[model samples]
Target chain A: MNAAPPPERASPAGREAPRSSVLVAERLTRRLEGEVPVTLVEEADVQIGRGEFVVIRGPSGSGKSSLLYLLGLLDRPTSGRLLLEGEDTSGFDEDRLADVRLAKLGFVFQFHFLLNEFSALDNVMMPMRRLGRLDADARRERGLRILRDLGLAGHEHKRPSQLSGGQRQRVAIARALANDPVIVLADEPTGALDTKSSGNVRDILRELASGQDRSIIAVTHDLHFASAADRQIEIVDGRIVPTGTMATLEAAAAAAKAAGTQTGAAPAS
Target chain B: MSLHLDIAFSHLRSRRRQTVVSLLGVVLGVAFFLAVSALMRGSELDLVARLVDTAPHITVYDEYREARPQPARLLWPEGAVAIRGVKPKAERRGIRQYRRKLQTIDAIRGTQAAPVLVSQAIFSFAGRDEAVTLSGIEPARMKGVSTIDEDIVAGSLDAVDTNPNGIIIGRALARKLSLEMGDTVSVVSPTGNVRAMKIVGLFETGNAGYDEGQTFAQLTRVQALMNRPNVANLIVVRMQDAYAARTAAAFIERSLGYKSVSWQEASKDLLDALTVRNVIMYTVVGAILLVACFGIYNVISTVVLEKTRDIAILKSMGFHARDIRLIFVIEGAVIGIGGSLLGMAMGSGMMRAVEQVEIKPPGSTESITLPIYWGIDQFALAAAFAILSAVFAAWLPARKGGRVQPVDILRGAA
Candidate 1:
């Protein structure tokens, strides 16, 4: 589905988002109350267009995961607005937000988070059953197809406890795509994986984003993972620091190290 | 099955031991409920049956319920007729036109009626005197109306019909007076007309009082001795359906103008006692089921506590709070219903065991088994209580599970 771009260089500007964008965050913020109040995401603005793989990269405690959660409609923003296909979601109630999450967006957490009681096939069918767009047999057929496509065909009956770490994560992804949501959000998708498994997950995610024309927004500290995305938004403290390309993210990480500050993760080095 | 039901099954299966233990609570509770109710109901029915067997269903006495109005008061309307502190004329005390009233009573369907000439008499032998209640009955009609036929241990009731001067006395009285069959005793009515009557039949009703004080004789003989010819004092009735006695008695009193008392009216205190017993039985049995409900509540609350993260994940997966609640409620209902079915079977067995216990009451010569009433409604009652307890037990934890926020769990796990 990635027809070669029509020869004009893709614009680096994100603020003037086109109508084809899937999710838009307009200066969204999230605040947590405590003895000492915390701001998880502060005034973050980003636009994710269809068929794009976008990354939010930062150091530890940089609020990248918080921003991704807000964009995915898992959490209500403290101020500013988020739009899904140009509909403002700031006023949506909790149930309505869940409906949006079920029908429009999907999620993969740092842990696989598959229900331990269910088998891999049942896990994949959970979202489809919830959405109720398909009957039981059809849901089963579609779930098997998704699992088979992700190379878990024979492992359909295996419980989450029986599957390897990477296999479990793939089951989680299969579950997320069960309803064919247009936007798939991942928070540290490779956070619990080994080197080779994380590489496998990254490649699979890249293919799913571009090959199917589905937008993917993921948060990670892995610079190598960020460099593969079409666009990257860097977070420092709670605010987004925009970047133009893979080169800009590499340059920023290099500059941080030279200036004696913690840099974005570069596992490849 | 629905998805929530499937999930509920899985959750219970995962904690099978805990589920079974809670289920045991319900099973024992329901079993005890059925057994206790059956015993209580069975004993009540047995007591009423014995009561009905011993007494006439309805008794119409010769006496008027109210004093007969004087002719002067009847004739003087609004004339300020005052007869205060005046005694009525003491006329013949027996019922007039008694043969006609007996025929009227016999015509009433679903009843057996017999006229009896009852009088207080004294039996004297060798200068020893004893008081007795002489009930002179028509042997054929008495056979149909009175349980005395069954209590006769020696000669049948027909022996008294054969000999005009024959008397059937209870064994206790025969023993006390040292009289036997073919022995003669002088029976003197309260008005002093006396005759030497031979004992032709002997009966022992296992009631010491009735055996000692009550005796039976031919109706003609008692009427002659009492100087109450062509008159009877009581008409004892046995109905086809004992419960219909009140209405029958009322009709009899209204038509015959005699005071007809039904067994139910005669024993109001006994019926009231049975009703109070039933109330206490239900309260104690209901408390058993309530404790079973608490067991269910404890188990479900623990399941909710242990599965909080799972609930959070389900909520995050677009499951509504109600769906989560439904899963746990279904779990509770499953256990409750399962336990009820098992308990019903066990309770039936328990009731059978109870029915086999033999006890001879005081002063009884033979052993009798306990009465067991087997009513299907007790099963329904037990099931209703079981399901209600289970549903209510599930509701508390279900509401808590439904209100769980995914964000809270996710943040804590992170």
Candidate 2:
């Protein structure tokens, strides 16, 4: 899928979700098996549609990342069905699920997780090669273009170890966008970056959802990053808690909206 | 996919030192395997050829497998007949009408057959008398079955045909009887038949016992002296394919009612020894590759352990478990191909060195080069084994890589 146009600088239009949903899930649950059986995600119903920047927020053990993984098709739900682009994925095998993820979903983990052995260009070429729509030359050109767009123009030949933390994360973002997936899933994209790099990463993620027409789902505890999203979900103890009881989160969002600024990380309790 | 190979090669190239260390194991294993296999098989084949060449490929004797039943026992269907001794009507002992049997033997394809009369006799020359085996043969036909013509040391085998009363004796026998070319020797057969024969040829076959105890003469003269004219009691047959001797001999025996024996049957113990030697060689060589496989397993398993995050990342990036497995297997294939090619070259070099080595065997003056077998089958075997071991070594870690769950690693890292 082609990326959406640059996000409008006008009033936010993400709360109105009645347009079209790219991914739909019903009562999805993931339970770990052991002597002490633990449930990671408990009957979570969610919808991620076009042009929405959704942030998953929770305490340390709230299964926020688990929910994102379930939605990203990296983890299978124990007893619920997931629909991707209006196709049922409940019966898809491992390989088929991977194909769907490759074609439809992109992921950016907390550590940036760029393959250390490969150059920035090759790392971005991975997903494009997996899709196999373009020949090698086209894939390389597409890879270089994505890197250039992400401000990694001269660093294409540098490995992850040679690049800075922010550059590496940008390379990861470039990789996520290589195949032009319908949705991007980031498990704390700015979790390990400094304040400056974290701000740059947050801005990049926001533009991805609002401007590029591609939906984004990120897991984060940063109140500032959470407040900038079109929608914020708070998960507590493997369950999604309603937004009304989370006063600090609501307070942060309202204050950031009133100030007309992009960050809402003040007064984090 | 090329992606798999691409990743595989990157992994190997990233860890260059460990890759070389692991590669050397397979290289040495394969090289030693080829070198040792060449030496063992080369020597064994040389020994077998020498043994096989020294005797006729197939020999047919004039005898029935079992004697006929007594007349009384044959006549009484239900009665028990006991006899202490039994004798049949008098009959001639030699093969009757052997010329006709020779014609039937000559009709078979892929074989050369010759008739011979073998009898024991005592030889007397000057004042010495020693027992010897006198073989009566047609010189023209005997050459097809035996290598005595090539081993002729003093005179030619063809001289027996031109000389009317010719006898070919071994050099050791000539020394024992003080007989040389043109010397007449006296022989007394078992039936008291005596004859004086002129020695026309001499042969030396490197076997002291055979050289001292065997002699050859014209078939017609032997039959006349032994009082069994126009008869041959035995036939020696040689075939183009030594391995096909059993079938050919079986055909001859079935058609002629004679006891046919192939060289294979006569030297079964020696052949069995060769088979046992092969088993031992393979087991030892297999152990070497197995050890090399363990070395590969160690290196790849360490790579898997170290690169767990890379595996998790690739899995999260939408790579299938099969892709992970293919990457590791490709790594193994790289090692297999590289090791086998270099090992064969190194092994060929070792074989050349071995071929240049000279040794003087016991009881011989001239130094001879050591035997080295160079055959293509060994190369194929070394390569097949190298690849198999390499693939097997990678299996454990590849499976581990395929089973990697990105969430666990991510959770742990978080």
Candidate 3:
């Protein structure tokens, strides 16, 4: 397992290497409740490399979301090692964990949890506003840019209820990426989306992962999404099963595409 | 901080019903607080003014000793202890010197001499004679030195000067004697020595103690009746500042013991009642403010609940707990300041309205009419109380908002 790990390159003094894989968790464990006390992840060491598209696939109770939460520093593990941008996370309290999460990670929930009060642009601008360094014009500019990137520029003034499900999800994604976090963690992001909407969101996630070279660890039950990742990790009964990479998944997908072409025009389009 | 305020308002705006409820709480609280505060001030000012107008700011009395008969004085026991009194015996010999000492007090306006005589006198007015103790004061000196001048209702004070044997009396006393101005009244001493004085005027002093039992006459005449010429038993002093009465009286007593009493010390019962009323006013008004703050707490707590999820999300976004608390505190402060201003306006308006309604005394009686004057200090006090209540009410909710955990609330545990 290469226990000593690699000698990571030192970031330039006073400058963090952009797109650093800022989250690491090894052998993470969580107890749900009761005397039995289920361990969510045991001896599970996962490295989400910089710019890597890491997809975790599992069934409903496979603790896939739990691992994502642990990596995002939203929940503490009963016992395990977690390093956020190479700093040991065990010593971090709730407040310190919040600091790490706010500075380094973004989250997209299965349900698009948009704060219902604010318009889409304001929702995206909220984190920056709370941080309070930027003036009004700067906040507006940054918010518009993120909204524009998410294809939500036109819907920026609309409330969440006025937007389509895909648009709402995109807004949530924009809000998540507002801080330009080092990593984006999505748990069942497409679970509420239709096939078309899901594919659009999947495209957005892939772009975020590769073009921006932001590390993405998405939890999904979708085999195709998991297979399409730079790496596929399977979890069953709270432990990860070793898996292969995008090259193998691409070959398999291509074979499936070819086979499907003879029968129907590739499902939707 | 501005960012937190924006967030706080956004959260508050998100729940319109709750925000309105909270704002209503603050408004009512402030209004009641200010109203009660103003009422208390109005009542207190009226009482103090009444006292200041009718009562002497300072009074002086004779320090007396039980005169010993000849045998007891000649066979006086060795080392016989004498009681120490308000004035020492040596100072009592030169008592007139004490009146001069009162002049040193900056607020001493003037002094009036009254001979408090113990001789039994029969007062025959409207064909009846009743025995009473006689008190005498010079009319001009009384007008110059006491509150008696303005208190005269029916007749001129100069009338007392025109007739050497003239006297002024309380309306109740005059009614009891069935006498009017210009009616001659015969006063017979216990020794069968009689004198007649004309009814000069009638006065009403509001207080029952003075109105029922007091009569004023020319000082020298009463002095002759008491068999002491050019001598007064008691001297009443008036001061420019009412608050300085007690201090001045103390200084005068040390210089001339048994020679003076401040209005407060003379009328302890009345003064005590005034003090108690002041305390009760503060307590009752304070309780009203407390109730108002309670309402504010109710409204803000609901606000805290409605914003819990937003607070969690904000916390997750790296806003500290202190920041969350500050947001709610700002909200509370805004409500407090607005309510306080509103309360002050409403209270001042109420006082003005009250002052405008003329309270006429019964049946065209020439009596004292009291007015409620709005003082600046009253408004400041009410505003201060309202603000304190508002801040206090907001404190608990702000703390609860701060303590909310982001993950717990997002997971619906909060």
Candidate 4:
């Protein structure tokens, strides 16, 4: 039987669409350590809808992280059209990019890289204080609200060194959410968590993407995590294989529930 | 901006150890500069003060090169030959007549006319005798022209005014003869005349010129002792204008025939020495300020380097380069202002301390005291130098900070 066609990603109308896609890629490519350059997403015409749960997935060294970085504006793409909210960001200088990152975007790295010197509340307030428009009371109120929202209210005064790994990651999440960013580009949000913590982080990501109406483009190699996403793009050797069918919920349910199931959707192991 | 200032202050407070070490050089340099300058200025005050004690600001004297015609001689009528074959005497008589003409000049407000007797006097007291120049002065009139009133330490000038037989002797002379107040001293003039006088007061001008070689007496008494009537030697005139003394002297010279000089001319070397001292003091202080500026530059430069990351973050967050520069400049300026004020207080206190200590007179059986002079100008200059040096010191390092790139800062490359 012929595989189902890929779903077209179009920005929703009327809801004051995201500046553009939280992540946009046209032939997004990155190269590491000598030899031929790896095309992370070859002419990968993808637009992340506002408040959409878009996931990029592939095996290790498949350029998933590279695509996330290029989209997050953390790393530059060699040759690609990156229109953040329909504005060309390819020529944006570092300072301007930092402004976009501060006012328009937030990032959740795989390692939960929180500044070690400050307490969790201070870390949450870092972006707002750095931006410098808010007074002390305002910054404190905003930081505390975010920490409480992330279920880490009691941990607000604790330093990162004083917190557990999960708590530290939650603090990082609170920090990213502090300034109320339009989009959260989390690179492997649950990549380092235990099974329970991983599910917790995944559930939070899903809620932020669907419930709170924030565009989330998370990069992950876990098929289980990617499977629950609204949409997933599988990259291999820097290119998306357009011939493969996009597996729907029915297909996913059948693959997991049927006995002696011979599945063609799983990667050829 | 106050916010940044608050931040800067708190930041410095946080790094108290480094701030103290850094500010130590500035503090010491300011204090040293202020103290030395104050002492030099004090020396100038002392020199001027001593000169002001002995030097005559205005001398109204006999401008006549020769003796003036006495009132008794003037009775012979105008152009009458009073002396036969004594042309020098007659010429002296004419010049003396001219000196009498100066009395009519209205600008001569106060005159202390005295016969400056140049004859060697054998001043014998307690069997010890020495040659001395007797300056016969009207005690009341001398107070208007010089600081002679301050010279009297024992007895009184009023006694010299009341008693014609009274004389004012120097402290050195009193010591040399082992004499005290009320002791008799015999003055034997070169004319083979002798007169005994009682010592009424001891005067100390703190200078050998006045203290060692001179004695004061009533002008009439000295005139009678010399048997010179209607004939006075040099007349020391005191006038209303201290600075105009030279011009007044020149006027007197042109009007009459005697030579007259100003206090400035009399003590030119003393004044010159004071000026040279002032220049040397400024140069020494300037060197201190220069070194302080350089030290501050190094310290502030190091601080800038340490704060480069924070500066970058500030800039990226919308702080302008000018603002960052202002922070450091303000920091330096604050250091300078603080150091200057503290140093001035310290220096002024030091001067007061010097004044409080009494140093015994060396080689003497008495005590002597000196005061440390403080002036408004000295403090003003020192304070201005410190503040200017600090601002100038901030320039180089502040410029370097302005050149820092945000990209490099975030990357830890700055």
True contacts kept of each: 0.33, 0.82, 0.51, 0.02
lDDT of 3 by residue, B266-350 (tens): 6789768868876887787777767766766776788788767767777766767777778877777766777777777666676
Q: Write the number of the candidate with greater TM-score, choosing between 2 and 3.
A: 2
Q: How accurate is candidate 1 locally (lDDT)?
A: 0.86
lDDT of 2 by residue, B1-414 (tens): 988888998889888888898899999999999999999999988987886688888888877666767777789957987877677657776677888888887887878888899889899888888999988889899999888889998778878778858889999989877788889988899899888889999999989999999988888878877888988888988888888898988888899888888898889899999999999999999799889888788888988898899999888888899889889988988888898898899999999999999999999878988788999999899989998999989988999999999888988998
Any idea what lDDT model 2 has? 0.86
What are the runs in model 1 whose C-alpha is more than 4 Å off? A1-48, A57-103, A233-241, A244-269, B62-112, B139-141, B158-166, B181-184, B196-200, B218-221, B229-232, B244-260, B360-363
DockQ of each two-chain model: 0.44, 0.71, 0.34, 0.07
Question: lDDT of candidate 3 vs native?
Answer: 0.70
TM-score, candidate 2, is: 0.93
Candidate lDDT scores, in order, read: 0.86, 0.86, 0.70, 0.69
Error of 4 at B9 (Å): 5.2
Q: What is the interface RMSD of each candidate, in Å?
A: 1.2, 0.9, 3.0, 5.9
Clashing pairs in 2: A4-A212, A4-A213, A6-A211, A7-A211
RMSD of 1: 6.1
Cα TM-score per model: 0.83, 0.93, 0.78, 0.60
lDDT of 3 by residue, A11-95 (tens): 2331233445556778888776778877776667888777778899865677787787778787788888888778898998777
Q: Please state the error at residue A153 of candidate 4 in Å.
A: 2.0
lDDT of 1 by residue, A1-269 (tens): 12122112233443244538778889898999899999999998888887789989876788888888788887788899998988999888888888888887778878899888899999888887888888888889888888887889899999999999999999998888888777889989998999888888888788777666678899998877777787888887788865643456567678778988764664232
Task: Sort the candidates on DockQ, descending order.
Answer: 2, 1, 3, 4
lDDT of 4 by residue, A1-269 (tens): 01111111223452355444555667766654358743555556677877788788766666666677667766666677788777789898766776777766776766666655468997778777656656788889878877886788788989788998778878877777666666787778787888877777788778777666677888887777887788887766666644233344336646655755666355442
